[model samples]
Structures are given as structure tokens and as C-alpha cells.
Target chain A: MNALLRNKLRAFLTMLGIIIGVASVIAMLGIGQGSKLSIQQQIAGMGLNLVTVVPGSQQRGGVQFGASTMQSLKETDVAAILSDCPAVLAASPEVRGNGQAVFGALNWPTSLYGENESYLQIRERSVTNGRMFTDRELSSAAKVCLMGQTVVKNLFGEGADPVGQVIRFKKIPFLVIGVLDSKGLNTFGQDQDDLILAPYTTVQKRVLAITWVQSIYTSAVDSKSTADAATQIEETVRRQHKIKASDQDDFTIRNQTELLSTFSSVSNILTILLGAIAGISLLVGGIGIMNIMYVSVTERTREIGLRMAIGGKGFDILLQFLTESILLSITGGIIGILLGIAASKIIGSTMGWPIVVLPSSEILSFAVCTVIGVFFGWYPARKAASLDPIDALRYE
Target chain B: MKKLIEIIKLKKDYYVGEVTVHALRGVDMVVNEGEFVAIMGASGSGKSTMLNIIGCLDKPTEGEYILDGISISSLSKNDLSGLRNQKLGFVFQTYNLLPRTNALDNVELPLLYNKTVKTKERIERAKSALESVGLSDRMHHKPNQLSGGQQQRVAIARSLVNDPVVILADEATGNLDTRTSYEIMALFQELNNKGKTIVFVTHEPDIARCATRNIIFKDGVILRESEVKDRINALEMLASIPLEAD
Candidate 1:
């Protein structure tokens, strides 16, 4: 320890590799974990235990038509799923269209979604201002609708209350009854608050003039029962369509759990890759320790001889050198940990990345450094210990 | 008188690839307690090898060496180190005090190897040892801060700190000037008068004359041995040399 303190600059330089290595390890892992958590939060924001059934691709005379064009999912399928699937809590039939919404002289292009009253609950949305449309409004194919924040901002200007105001979508007049809470942008960079919601019967009768829904959105009783609810909905839908056992289903089910797991696995692989790259740097740091220790032993040959001459033993000399290296590495480790955490915090704020510094990573890096210290310090210390006292004394 | 060092039929062989160089052919000698002896020889005359054997730093190829009644030839490496710590002190030609360390700490080094000496006692002993070598004033000065003679004094103090059976000096004044050499010799004579056993090694006759007895080595054997009939007092010699103010 005293030996290391004697040449403070050299000691610090030798520890540079370790500091950088540990700091990088910590920073990389933090970013990996942070991004992973952010992804999860964004996905969860879409809604929990939510499942969607979209119409599969269809073929007529061996000519293929792409997905969501089959017109196989009807309003009855949503009702059948809710009644037959015990795991389902709520279900809504959906019809989607894109049109320009006009208010007074202002107009904005946006999406319009047609759904029943249960649509808000299944999508985990709420009416922040006015009330949602009642079932009577759905039965009558009422044109009353709810506006999202983006639509409200574009058509009616910011902070303007759109409820009870009239807007025209595709030249058809509709009365706005409520404004949905803001959800910002989702993981795919799509604006969740840029659409308007109205009764599915209105879009089916007046907009597309089709009897079939584009898709069905359903919520499960709990997150754990989502898969079971998906399976039950598939069976119920198949039975309603009276599809044969040998034939392929005309609808496909997608759930949040599958999406969540896929994202989690990808992020986990990314974390490991980053950690492995950082570990290589740590290995380089260990080699640096070994190199310095060897140089130190060679430079202090006379000192070792003098100590031995004055009654110091081989074991004592070994311990002295080993202790110095260990002290160097551990000091570097501590400083690196501090620098890493600071770097993580800075990145988190400056880059807007969610940074989570896991305690396990810090402990893992600390323990690894100590092991590196011992492993790299051993050979040089042993070389010093095994030197011949007479030859060492005579060494220039 | 008690025998502090005993050597009988001591022979040392060194292998230089194909040839075995005989460093010490059969040699027999003994020094009693409180006697100052000088081992004299030219380069490669086996005097350094004898000193190394006496210092317990090396094991002889074939010999019987007993220091203060303990047989050194039968001891293990660890036991030899313990023996060196307990019963031996060494002073070198270059005054090999650790650089950047103060005189007190340099002197305290030998006692550091001795587990029985506590820190408080170690410090006290080191202080007294430095005082005995007349380096009490320079106790806190580093080796680089002191002159060559003062550095030698610190080395002597370190040798005395452990209260060993004998002090073995290999050209202790080899690197010093005439005035400083005599000054160090004078300190050695003073320690001798206080009944400390010392074995001084040198090639200079004048330096050898400071000791009570001398043994000359030639071609790996002792050529002659004699007691100093007219022992020169280093203090008187220092007085004879006219002082030049620095």
C-alpha cells in the first residue's frame, strides 16, 4: 500500500484500465435494463389482459386476399365470445375508417374508430370530461362520439372542450359527447390520442355500410387467464361460423403476454451482449494489473533483498507485493462504481433513457475485481518471494 | 568466553553450467562473543561466500555451521529465516536503507520481522539503537536527506535494533571517503567496547587493523590468520587527519 502511494501517478495510470472497464460494464448494463423497463411500460400502457381477434386472409377461386379483409368477424362474434368465454370480462366489436374531421373552418386528417360502450373499458381508456355513449345510443346507430386529445387539438384548437360540439367526418355530422384521456405515443411511435371513437353500428350502417366488424377487442378477467380467454374465444367464434374441424379458422387471436415475452427475450439477449463486451475490457484490465505488478517486482529487487537481509522472510515479501496490487485494484473498483453511477444518471437525464442501476451488477463487478486482483497479483508476488536473497542483494 | 560462530570443514561449491566452481574449500574458524573480527581477501577469494554462509543467506554444499549453539545445516528454510531474524544482523557496502523511509522506520525494519516485538517496544528499541549509532538527531530524516556516512550510521542502527548475536558487515565503509570511513570505524569500535560481536569484511589493511583480529582468504581457503598486535584507534586516526570545514 505504501509502495503504491509512493508513485501515485503510476498507480492511477495502472488503475485506469480497470476504472474504464468497470464503468463501461455498469453503464452498458444500466442502459440495457432501462430500455427493457421502458419497453415493458409502453406495452403495458396499451392495456392489461387485452386480446384482439382480427379476420384472417381469405381466398376466392385460388386468388388470395390479405389479412383483415375476410369480413368474417361479425358483431355476433363479440357477443358470443363474452357469453361463452367465462375468462372474458368484456368485449367490443370494432370498425375503423380514416377521414378528415372538420370543425368550423378548421379541418384535420385522423382515424375514426367505431365501437360499443364496452370499448373504453377493454382499451383501458376513460372519459375525462363528458359521459360515454349509452347502449341505447349504440342500438340507434347514434352519431354521438368521443374525441381524443390530438383530434381535439387539431380540429377545435388546444384546451378547447369538444363535448356537445358538432364535427363532420367525411361530410357526415356527428355530435361529440366526451374527450378521452391522453395516452401520448405508444412503443411503435403511433399517436394513441389522435383518434375519435363512436358507436360501431354508426360506422357499419353509415360509413362502410357493412354488416361485419373488422375485428373484436376483448379483455380477460385477469392477466393470467388471457391465454385461456383467447382459446375460448377462438372455439366460440369457430362454432358460430360453423367451420368444420378439418378447416382452418378464419380469425386469429393476439394477446399482450406473447408480445411482452418476445420483447423481454430480445432485451435480455441485448443485455448479455453488452455485458460480454464490457467483460472483455475487464479482462484487459486484469492483464494491465499483471503487467504493472511484474514491473514493480523487477524494479524493487534491491528492496526485497534489503528486507530479506534485515530479517524479512520470503512470505513477508510476497504478502507485501500482493497487498499492494489488491489495494490498487479495490481502490480502482470503488472509483469506477461511483463514476459508472454518475454516468448512468447523466445519460438518463440528458438522453431521456430510463436508467436503472441494479445492485447485483455493482456487487458482481466488485467481486470480479477482487478476484482479478488476486489472480493477477499472484505470479509477480511469487516471483519476488522465490528470488535468491544473495543474488538479489547484488542486483544493480 | 562464549562461542558465537562456529564453522568446521565448511565447503561451498557453485555450478557454472559444465564446471563446478569451488567457492570455499575446507575452512574452520570460530569467533567468541564480544570479539571484532575482520575477514580480508581480494575479489573472488571466497570471503563474500563465507560471509553469505555466516549470514545464513545461503546453504553450503557440505559444511557444519553453528551460530550461538544452533546447528544451521539442519534447519529448514523457514527456520533459517527465523534464525536470521533472531540471531543475525547485516550491514552492506552500499548502505542499503530503504529510500523515502525515515531513519527511525529504516532502523525499525529488522524488528518488523520479529513477531515477539510489539509496535511500542519496536519503536523504543529503534530509537535507542539510532541513539547508540549517534544518529538520534537524524531519526526522522530520509536516506536521501542524509549524507553517505549518516546513511551508514542508520544501517548500523538497524543492525543493532534486533539485539542479534553478531553483526556481519560486508565492506560497510567501501563506498565512504577516508574521513567518513574512519568515522564509521570509530562507531564500530565504540560498539565493540560495549561488548557487541561484529565480523567486518574488507580488503583494506588500514580498515582491517581497526578490528581485534584478521583472517586473510586466498583461492577459496584461509591463507593466514593473526591478531592485531598494534590495534589502531579510529578516534585517534580521525584526530590525526586535519579537519576541513564543509
Candidate 2:
């Protein structure tokens, strides 16, 4: 301890390597963990037990046309999935088109979605004001619709009740029956509350004059059975389309659990990569300790000899050097932890990145510092302990 | 008188690559308690080899070395260190005191290895040792702050702090001027009068004349041995030397 204090500048410089290593490890891990948690939260907000079936791409003469171009899925697939697939809780057929909605003198461009009464349930959305359009209204091909928070805000002004108000889309008048609860922005930064929903029959017969639906959205009995519901929907759709055995699926089925796993795995790899890079810095820090210790042992050779001549045992010399290095590393570890937490907070606020510091990372870094101290400190201490008293005394 | 050191036919050989250099060849010597013995020789004459063996810092190839009635050949490395701590003291020509440490702390160094000596007792013993060497006023001064003579005095204080059975000094006055050399020799003579067994090694005949007995060495063997019938009084010699102008 006296020796280390005597060479204050050298000791602090040696500890700087360890300090930077530990701080970077902790900060990198925090960012990685924070990003992973944010991804999971956003995926959870999407909905529960959801399974979406979309028309696969059409490949005519090997020149592939992208997804939703085949028109493989139809309105009949929704009925077939609800009745045949016992795992399904509810299902809805969807058709969409872009149009400008007008209310009085106010107008805003928005997406128009055509869906049945079960669409809100499958998507885990609810009407905040008024009620949903009835089955009688759908059978009569009623021009009734529901307005999302964004559309209502743009057409009728902010906080205005658009229910019972009339809006026009493509020169056709429609009555707004209800207002959807606000959902804010999704993971992709797209506004969830920016669309208007109407009966699928009204969209197909009155708006587009098309017979086939674009996609089918369904919900499973529970979150655990989401994959099973997707499989059953695939089987029923294939049978309806007459896609024979040993042929490729004409419609692709995706479930929430599969999407969640895919996203989590990607984030997990990112976390590991970040940790490994930080670990390389830590390894370099250990090498720095070894280099400094070697130089210290050489510089103090005569001192070691004098101590030995004065009756200090070899083991005592070894213990002295080892203790010095360990003390250096532990002190650096403590300062690094504080610095890392401060850095993480700064990054979180300034860069707008999520940062979550785990207690386990702190504990792990502390333990690693001790191990590094011992491992890198061993060889030089042994060299000091093994010196011949006579030769060492004569050393210049 | 009880014998503090006993060596029978001590032999030390050094193998420098292919050839062997006989550092010490079949030597026998002894020093009884309360005796001042000086071993005098030139370089390569085995005087240092003899001192190293007596100090328990080196092992003899073919002999028995017993210090304070314990056989050195039978002891392990750790035991030899413990023996050096408890029974033998060493004073180097260069005044090997720790650089940044104060005189008192340097004096207290040997006692640090003796775990039984508590900090309080160690400090008290170190203070008394410094006082005995006439360095009480310089206790807090570091080696760099002190003069050459003062640094040697600090080294002497360090050796005395352990209260060893024999104090082995190699060329103790070699680095000092005539006046300071006599002054240090007078300190040793005073310590000897108090019954401290001193073994001083030097090549200078005048310094050898300060001891009660002298043993001369040549070609790794004892050339001659005699009692100093006309031993020089270091105090009287110090009085004869002219003091330097301030």
C-alpha cells in the first residue's frame, strides 16, 4: 500500500484501463437490454392471440408479383375458419382503400377499412363513444361507419364527437355510428388511429365493386392456442382453395407468438454481440495490468532484495505485490460503476435511446475485476518472490 | 565464553557456465560472544563469501555453519530467513535504507517481519535504537535528506533494532571520509563495550586495527590470523583528524 501511494501517477494510470473497460461493459449491456425490453413492449401492444392470413404473391412465368396480388383469400375463408377451426375465437374479412373523408368544410386524407362486426374484437379494439353498427345495418348494406381518433380529429376537429355526423368518401355519404378508442403510434411509427371502418359488403359492392376480400384476421381462444388456430386456418383455407396435398400454401398465415419470438431472437443476438465487444476491452485492460505489474516488479528489484535481507520471506513479497494490484482493480471497479450509470442516463436523455442498467451486470463486472486482478497479478508477483537475494541486491 | 558463530571447514563453489570458481575453499572459523572480529581480504579473496554464509544469506557447499547453537545447513529457506530475523543483523557498505521512508521507519523494518512485535512496541524499540546510534534528532528525516554518515548511522540503528546475537558489517567505513569513518568506528567500539558481538569486514589495515582480532584471506583461503595486541582506539583517532571548515 505504501509503495502504491508513493507512485500515485503510475497507479492511477494503470487503473484507468480497468475503469474504461468496466464502464463500457455496463453501458453497452444497459442499452442492449433497454432496446430488447422496448421491442417486447411494442409487440405486446399490437394485440393478443392474433393470427393474420394474407394472399401469397403470384408468380406467373417465374416473374414474381409481390404479396396481396393473388386474390387467393376470399370472404368465405372467414366463415370456414370460424366454423371448422375450433381454436378460433372470432374471425373477420378485411378490404381496404385510400380515400379522402369530408365532414362539413373540413377534409383529411385517410385509409378506409371494410370489416364485419367481429373485426373490432379480433383486433382488440373498442368503441369509445356510441355503439357498433348492427347486423341488420350490415345486411341492408348500410352506409354506416366508425371513426378513429385521428380521422375524427382531422374531419370534425380535435375532441369533437363525430358520432351521428355525416362524412363523404368517394362521393358517397356515410353516417358515423361510433368513435374508436385512441391507440397512438405503433412500432413502425405509423398512426393506428388514422383509419375509418365500415361493413365489408358496403366496401365491395358500393366502393370497389369487387367480390374477393384482401385478407382475413382472426383471434384464437387464448394466447397459448394462437399457433394452433393459425394451423387450422391454413388447413381450412387450403381445402377451400383446392390446393392439393404436396403443394405450396397459396395463403400465408402469421401468428403473434411467431412474430414475438422472431423479434426477441434478433434482439438477443444484438445483446450478445454488444457484450462480446465490451469483453474484448476488458481483456485488453487485463493485459494492461499485467504489463504494469511486470514493470513494477523490475523497478523494485533492489527493494525486494533489501526486504529479503532484512528477513522478509518470499511469500511476504508475493503477497505485497498481489495485494497492491487487487486494491487498484477494486477501486477502479467502484468508480467505473458510478460513471457507467451516469453515462447511461446521459445517453438515454440526450440521444433518446432506452437504457436499463441491470443489477446483475454490476455484480458480474465486480466479480470479473477481482478475477482480472488475480490473473494478471500472478506472474509478476511470482517473479518478485523467486529473485535471488544476492543478485537482486547487486542489481542496478 | 559462549560461541555465537561456529564454522567447520566451510566450502563454497560457483559454477559460471562451464568452469567452476572456488569462492571459498575448506575454511574453519569461530567467534565467541562479546568479541570484535574483522575479516580482511581483497576482492575475489572469499571474505564476502564467508560473511554471506555467517549472515545466513547463502548456503555452504561442504561445511557446518552453526549460529546461536542452531545448525544452518539443516534449516529450510523460510527457516533461514526467520533465523536471520531473530539472530543475525547485516550492515551494507552502501547504507541500504529505504529511500522515501524516514529514519525511524527504516530502523523498524526488520521488526516488521517478526509478527509478535506489535506496532507500539516496534516504534518504541526503533526510537531507542536510533537514540543509541546518536540519531534521535534525525528520526523523521528521510535517507535523501540525511548526509552519507547520517544514512550509515540510520542503517546501524536498523541493524541494532533487532537485537541480534551478531552484527556483520561489510566495509562499514568504506564510503566515508577519515573523520566520519573513525566516528562510525568509535560508535561500533562503543557498541562492542556494551557487549554487542561485532564482526567487521574490511580490506583497509587501519580499519582492521580497530577490531580485537583480525583474519586475513587470500586465494579463497585464510592466509593469516592474529590477535590485535596494539588495537587502535577509534575515539582517539577521531580526535586526531582535523574537522572540515563549515
Candidate 3:
């Protein structure tokens, strides 16, 4: 304690490196964990049992038209998969396009989603106000739509009621029947609440002048059966599309399990990257500790001699110096943890980013700091302990 | 009195690169309980080496040293340390007290090594040791805060804390002026009168006059051993000197 106070500035400077190292480790891990958790939550909100079927790439006269252009998915396919695929619990046909939504001299560019009432259930969202399009409206191909929060804000202004009003998509007039509850953003950074939804029949017949939808969205009976439902969907669509056994599939099936694993793997890599970088900085801090401890041993040669002369064993001397170093590092570690938590909290609140500081990381950092102290302090303590008292007491 | 220290034909050699310097050559010495002895010699006469060996800080190249009935040659490093803690005390010319530690803490150092003593008892023993050396008022003062005489007195207290069988002092008054030297020697005389065995190493005849017996070293061997015809009591010597002169 006296030695540390004797060189307070140097001690603090030494601790500074460890402080920064630990703080950065904690903050980086917290931010990474926060984003990972946020991503997982967003995906889960999309429906854990959800699966998607889109048109596969088409080859015409040896020329490939890229995926999503073939438009092989139809409303009949949604009905067929719902009936034939036992694992499928719910299915909705989606005909997607982009257009300018016009309502009383106000216009906003937005993506249009043509889907049925079941689309709301499959997407795990509900109407904030008003009602969904009825089966009567869907059968008659009525011009009725539900606007998203972003579209409502852009076309009608914030807090403006748009239900019971008329809007235009591609110059076709449609009645606005409801507003969708907000879903901020997806993992791909796309705004999920920025599009409007309407009955598939109206969009396919009036806006695009087509009979088939662009994709089919389905939910399985349970999370465990999502992959089975995807395979069953592929078989049913294949039979409907009249593709032979030797021919390539005309549709592509994507399940939530695949997407979730891919995203989690990416997040895992990012967390490890951040942790490894933090570990390197901690190593640098450990080296700094080692350098300072060496200097301290050299400076306190006389003190070592005095203790040894007073019947202190070599082990006692070693323990004393080692304990001092461990105390220094652990103290720095605790302060760094506080600084890290504070920094992450500030950044989280100010920048509107999610932050999660896991208790495991805190414990791990504390443990690593102690190991670093022991590892780096060994040589210096040994040097102090091994000094010959006859010469050390005579050292200038 | 039982023999506290017994050495037969002690020899020590040092190797500086290639040449072996014989620091001690065939020296025989005996120190018994309750005896105050002074060892005097010129530089390179092995006085310091003899003190170090007797203090258990080093081992002789060729000798039979039985310290308080324990054979020095067969003891391990840990056992040597234990012997030093339980049996011998050392006081150096520079009064090698830790600089930033208080006088009481410095005195408590030896007790820290003695596993038999508990923490609370260690403090009380150190406090009384400080009081015995007349430094109770300066117990909380750091070594740097104390004068040369006071620092040496603290070192003496440190040596006495364990109640060792013998005390070894190498030029204990070398750094002090004549009056403070005499004052410190007065403390030593008082400790000796209390039945503490003290072995002192000095080159000055005046300081040698304080010990009851004198042994002079020449090269590595003892050249003469004699009792003081008239010992100078340090307390009486200090009374003759004026306070202002000190």
C-alpha cells in the first residue's frame, strides 16, 4: 500500500490500460449481445412456425429469368398446401408490388402487400383500429385495404384516422378498412411496418392484371414441424405445377429454422470477434502490469532485504508481492466493470441501441484479471524472493 | 550459562569470477547466554562475515556451527529461517528499517514470520518492544521521520521483538554522532543488563569499550580475545556529555 501511494500517478497510469481493456470488453460484448437478442426477438415476432414458398428461377429457351419473376405461385397453391400438407396450420398467398399510395392530394411511395385476413395472423400482428376485410369482400374482389403505420403517417399525416376513407393504388380506388400495428424493423434492416396489405384477389385482378400470386406464406402446426411443412409444401406445389420427377422444382421453400440458425451463427461470430479483440487488449494490459511489477521489484530491493533479514522466508516474500499485484489487478477490474456498464448504458440510451451486459462476462473478466495478475506477477515475485539477503541489504 | 552459540574452525570463501577470496580462515568462537561480546577488526578482516554466519544469514564453507543446539550444516533454507526467527536477531550499521513503514510495523515484521504468534498478540508484543527501546512515543512515525539514533533504536526494538536467544549488531553505531552513538549504546547496555545476549561488530575502540568482552579479528581468524578491564557504562558516558553539544 505504501509503495503504491509512493507512486500514485504511475499506478493509476498502469491501471488505466487495464481499465480501458475491461471496459471495452464489457461494452462490446453487451452491444453485440443486445443486437443478437434484438434480432432473435424480431425474427420470433415474424412467427416461429412460419415458412415461405417463392417462385424458383425459370429457364425459357435456355435463358434463366431469376427467382421471383416466374410467378408460379397461385391462390390455388395456398389452398392446396393448406389441405394436402398436414403439417401446415395456416397459409396466405401474397402478391407484392411497389406503388404510390394517394389519399386526398397526399401521396407516399410504399411497398404494397396483397394478402388475406390470415396474413395478419401469420405475420403475428393485429389491427390497431378498425376491422379486417371480410370473406364477402375477399370473394367479390372488393377494393378494400389496411394501411401500415408508416403509410398512414405519410399519406394521412400522424394521428389522422384513415379508416372509412378511400385510397388509390396504381390509380385504382380502394377503401381503407383498418391500420396495422407497428413492427419496427426486420433483421435485414427493412421496415416491416412500411407497407399496406389488401385482399390478394383484388391486387391480382386490378393492380397487376394477373391470376397468380408472387409467393405463398404458410405457418406450421408447431415449431418442430416447420421443416416438415416446408417439404410437404414443396411436394404439393410440385404436383400442382405438373413438374416431372426428373425435372427441377418450380418453387423454393424457406423455413424459419434455417433463417434463425443462419442469423444466430452470424451473431455468434460477431460476439467472438468482439471478445477476441477485447482479450488482446487485456493481454496488453497484462504486459503493462508485468512491466510495472518488474520496476517495483527493482525499486523495493531494500524492502525485500529488510523483510528477509527479519526472518521472512522466500515463500513469504513471494506471497507478499504476488498478493499486492493481484490486489492491484482485481481492483482495476472492478472499476473497469463499473465504467463499462456506465458507458454501455449511456450509449444505449443516447443512440437508441439495445444493450445487454451479461453477468457471465463480468465474472469471466474478473477471473481473467486475477489469472493475469498471477501469470504476470510470477517472474517478478520470484526475482524478489530469490534475492540473497547478504547482498540485497547492501544494495544501494 | 548454556552456550547460545558455538563455532569450531569456521571458514568462509568467496569466488569473484575466478579467484576465491578467503573471508574467514579457521576461526573458533563461543558465545554463551547473558554475555555481551564485541567483535572488532579492520576492513577485509572478516568481521562482517563472522557476524553474518553467526546471524544465520550465511553458512560457513568449513565449520561446525551449533546455534542454540541446532546444527547449522544440516538445516534446510526454511529451517534456517525458522532459526533466525526464533533464536537470533540482527541490527545493521544502516539500521535497515523499511522506509515507509511505521516504527511499530517495522518491529512487527519478525513476528509476521513466526507462525506460532497470532495477529492480536503480535501487535501487543511489538508495542511493548518499542516501549522497551524508549520509542513508544514514535511508534507511529515512519523511519524517515525518525533521527539516526531513533531509527537505530527502532531497529533494536525489531531485533528484540521475537525475544531471540542472541542479538547480532554489525556496526550499530556507525551512522550516528558520538553522543547519539553513546545514547544508542546506552540502550544496548540496558538490554544486556536485562539478560539479553548481544554480539556486536565494530572497528572503533570507544564503542568496543561498552561490551563486557572483546574479540579482535585479523584476516579471517581471531587474533585476540580479552575481557574489558574497565567497561564504560554508556549511561554514565552520556551524562558527562552536555545536551547542547549533542
Candidate 4:
């Protein structure tokens, strides 16, 4: 240890490159993992337990095909899907548009949504205040509304409770029954706590003045039977729309499992890409170790010769030198781990991502640096050990 | 009498690419315990080659070389190194101290390689060796910090650390001034009187005259060996040796 510390300048220069390289690897991996976790959460919150049914275009030998518009789904279609899809836990039909929302001199243009009470349950969203509409309210098509937390906050001040307050939407007055719990933002940059929810019947008859609904959502009991629920929903919707048996139906069902799998695949690829970039820096660092080790061997050649003269075997010289290199790299690896963790936190805080530093990966980086030191340091040390002592002593 | 080292018809050869150069030609000699012998030679003489072979730092081409009654010719490199570390010590013209290590640690280095000595014992023994050579006050001083005579004393201390059977010096005072050279010579005589055998090299007649006997070499063979009486005292010799004012 004293001998190792004696060559302080050489040790520090050798460890510097390794530290920077490992720190980069850690920071890049940390940030990348943070984003993956965050995105997964947002996707999971969207009732990844649910499946979405949209329209699939009919392909003819893969030519002259355009997207098939799914406009036939409506309140009745949603009801039939709920009843027939036994695997489904709940279901809802929703129509979305944009309109001016007013609450006594505070008016703002917001994304308008008309969805059934079950929409909140199917999507795993809940209200922080008030309650979902009653069964009578669903059948009677009440004019009451449920606003997202953001909409409420925008119309009212931060401290105000929006429940029981009457807000006007495009010249129609409706009392707010609930303010939604904040769901933050989704992967597509859309705020989940921004739109308003009301009865589908009212939205269909009044707001958009359209006859057909936009999309159908059916959630499974849990994660287990999402694909089965989606299949059942597709079958029910196709039959309720009264499409001909010979004609190709337009709607397609996409399960949360498939979407999640796709997301994870992309994220894994992204993680690897970022990791490889970091690994390249480590490779350069390994080369730097090789370079410095060669220089060290040259500088210590005479000393190596002296040790040999005094009873140090070739392998003894090799072991001592190799141990020195490994010690240098491991020390660098430890410092790099600390620096990388700190840098990752700084970046995460700045970008608003929840970065997590994994200890196992840090250990992995340290191990890799150790291997790098030994592997790259072997040749130069071997050369030093093989030098004839006679020539070495006679060397200037 | 116990023979510390013996050589019989030891021949050493060197090959440079396709050409061969014979460095030793069947040389035979024996060195006993506590014998201070000087081997004197000119350029291209085999005295240095003889020194290397006797020192166990090189293998003889074709000869039976026995050290401490064990045949060294057939010993593996590792075995030879072990023998050298346990039984022999060296002092070179350059003083050959590791650049960064201080005096005490340089003395400690051989003990470190042995590993049989406990850590505390190793340090204590090293300090004792330094103290024996009168370098205890300079124990922490690096080689570069010491003058020529002090550096040689540190090297002598390093040589004595393992209590080696023989202390070999190669042109030991070649790099020093006359005053320093005699001072180093006095230290060697002191160590020799303490029961350590000493073998050193020199071309100077005056330096050779200071030893118990001198073996003169010419063209790779010992031409003449002579014993001397009334050996000069180091300090008195330095005082008498003539002229420079600094």
C-alpha cells in the first residue's frame, strides 16, 4: 500500500480517465431507467388493465388501403359490450371535443369530454371531491358535470372547492359534481387531469351533435384476461353495429398487455443504445489504461530489474504490477460511482424525472473496470518482467 | 573451512542475433567466509561476467557452479532468486536505490519480498540496519536527497538488512569523489571486519591495494592475484592522497 501510494501522480492520472468514463455510464443508465419507469407508470395508470377498440383499415394485398373510420360505436354499443364481454370488469363510451368553459367571468377554452360514470372506474381515475353520477342520472341524462382537477383549478382559485359549483360550457350551465384527483401527464404530453366528464347521452344529443361515438373502452378484472376481454368487446361491438357477416368489420381491439410490451421493447432498445454509448466511453477509458500502463512499465523497468535481481520472480513482478493497476481502476470506479449518482440526481431534478441509481449496476461497472485494468495491463507488465536484469542494470 | 561459493570450469556465452560471443571460459574459483577479494579488469575482460555468474544473476553456459554447497547451474530461475535473496547482497557503482522510496523502505524492500518476517520485525530490522550503517538519522531521506557518500551508506544498509552471507560491490566508489570513495571504503572494511565476506571490483591500483587480495583480469582471465600487507587506513589515506583544494 505504501509503495502504491508512493507513485501518487501516476496512480491519479491512471484513475482519472476511468472515473470519467464510469461516471458517464452511470449517469446515462440512471436517467434512461428513470424515464422508462415514469412512462410505465403513466401507461399503467391509464388502466393498462383496459383495452381500447379503434378502427382497423381493411388491407387488400397490401395496396390501395386507407384507414377505416370507427364511427358506429355509441351508447348502445358500449352497453352491449359491457354486458356481453364477461371478462370485462367495466366499460364506457366517450365523445371528445373542444369548447369554452365559463364560471362567472373566468372563461377558458378546454378539451371537452362526455363519458359515462363507469369511464372513471374503467380508467382507474377517481375524484378527490363529490361523487359519480347515480343510476337515475345515467338514464335521465342529467346535465351535471365532473371536471378534471386542472379544469377546476383553472376556473377556480387554488384553494376553492369546485363541488356543487355551476359552470357554463359553451352557453349551457351544468353543476360540477366532482373534481378529479390529479393524474399528472401521460407519455404523449397530454394532461390526464385536464378534460371534463359528463353523461354520454347528453354529450351525444347536445354538445357535438354527432350520431356516432368515437371509441370504446373495456377494462379487464385485472391484468390476467385483458386479451380475452378485448376479444369479447370486439365480438360484441361488431354484432351490435349490425355489420354484415360477409363484409369486413372496421373496429380493432388493442389490449393493454400488447401496448405495454411494445413500450417496454422500445424502452429496452433505448436503454441498450444509451448504455452502449456509455460503454464506448468506458472502452476509451480502457484504452487510456492500456496507454498509461505501458508508460508505467517503461518508467519502472529499472525498478523491475532491481526487484528481479533481489529475488522477485517474474510472476511476482507481474502480480505486484497487476495489483497496482486493479487498485487504481477500482478506486476510480468507486469515485465514479459517487459522481455519477450525484450527476444523475442533478439531471433528474432539472428534467423532472425520478432517477434511480442501481447499486448492482454500479458494482457491475466497478467489476468491468477491474477486468479492464487486468486485461489491458497484462502485456506491458509481461514485457517488464521478461527484461534481462543484466541489460536493465546496465541501462541508463 | 566452509566454502560460501565455488565455480568449476564455468563457461558463459552470449548470442547477438546469429553471432555468438563467449563471455566466460571455464573459470574456476572459490570464495570462503569473510574473505575480502577484489577482481580487477579492463574493458572486454570476463571479470564482470564472472561477477554476474557468481552473484547468481546469470546462468553459466557449461559449468558446475555451486553456491553454499548447492549446485546452482541446474537450479531454476526462481530457486536462484530465492538463494540470492536469502544469502547474497549487492552494491553497485550507481547505488541503485529505487527513486521514490526513502532510505528506510529501500532497506525494508528485501525483507518485504521474503514475507517470513513479520511487519513490525521487518521495519525494526530495517531501522537497525540503517543504524548500523550510521544512516539512522537519514532513514526517511530519499536517495536524491542524500549526497554520494550518504547514498552509498544507505545502499550498504540495504545490503545488510537480510544479514546476507556475502556483500558484492561492483565499481562501488566509481561515481564518488576521493573523500566520499574512501568514506565508502571505510564502511565496507568495517562491515567486512564484522564477519561479512566482501567481493568488490575496481581498476584503480590504489583502490585494489586497500583490499586483502586483488585478482587482476586481462582478456577474460585472471592474470595475477596478490595479497597485500599494511593496508591503508581510509581517513589517513584520504588525508595523504595529494592535491585538490575544494
Q: A48-121 in candidate 3: lDDT tens per residue?
A: 78899999888899998987678788888998998999999899999877989998889999988888879878
Candidate 1: tens digits of C-alpha lDDT, residues A1-396: 668878889999989989988998999999989888887877766866888999988989988798777989988898899889999999999999999999999999998899998887888888899989998999999999899999999998899998889999999999999999999988679999999899999988988788999999999998789999989999999999999999999989999997888988999999999999998998899899999999999998999998887777889999998898888788888888889899999999999899988999999999988988999999999999998889999999
Clashes of each: 0, 0, 0, 0
Question: Which residue pairs in model 1 clash with each other?
Answer: none
* Model 2: residue B35 alpha-carbon error in angstroms: 1.7
All candidates: TM-score = 0.84, 0.78, 0.85, 0.81
Task: Judging by lDDT, tell me the better candidate of 1 and 3.
Answer: 1
Least accurate stretch of 10 residues (summed lDDT) in model 1 chain B?
Answer: B237-246
- Candidate 3 local lDDT, B132-192, one digit each (tens): 9998899999988999999999999999999999999999999999999999999999999
lDDT by residue (tens digit), candidate 4, B1-246: 788888888788999899988877767778888888889989788889988888889999998888888898788888988988898888888888988779999998888779798999999999999999888899999888999889888888888898898888889999998878888888888887888898888887778777887888776666887786867677687787675733
Best candidate, TM-score-wise? Answer: 3
Q: Which TM-score value belongs to model 1?
A: 0.84
**Location of the lowest summed lDDT over 10 successive residues in candidate 3 chain B:** B74-83
Backbone clash total, candidate 4: 0
- Per-residue alpha-carbon lDDT of model 4 for A225-311, expressed as tens digits? 887887778778779877788876777777768778888788778778888998888888878877877887787777877787777
> What's the TM-score of chain B for every model shown?
0.98, 0.98, 0.98, 0.95
Point out the higher-scoring one by DockQ: 1 or 4: 1
Better of 2 and 3 by TM-score: 3
Top DockQ prediction, candidate number? 3
Categorize the docking of model 1.
medium
- Candidate 1, residue A297: the lDDT equals 93
lDDT of 1 by residue, B1-246 (tens): 899999999999999999999999999999999999999999999999999999999998997999999989988877888888899889999988888889999999989999999999999999999999988999999999999999999999999999999999999999998999999999999999999999999999999999999999999999999999999999999998887832
Give the chain A TM-score for each candidate.
Answer: 0.79, 0.71, 0.74, 0.73
Off by over 4 Å in 1: A48-144, A157-160, A168-177, A181-191, A198-253
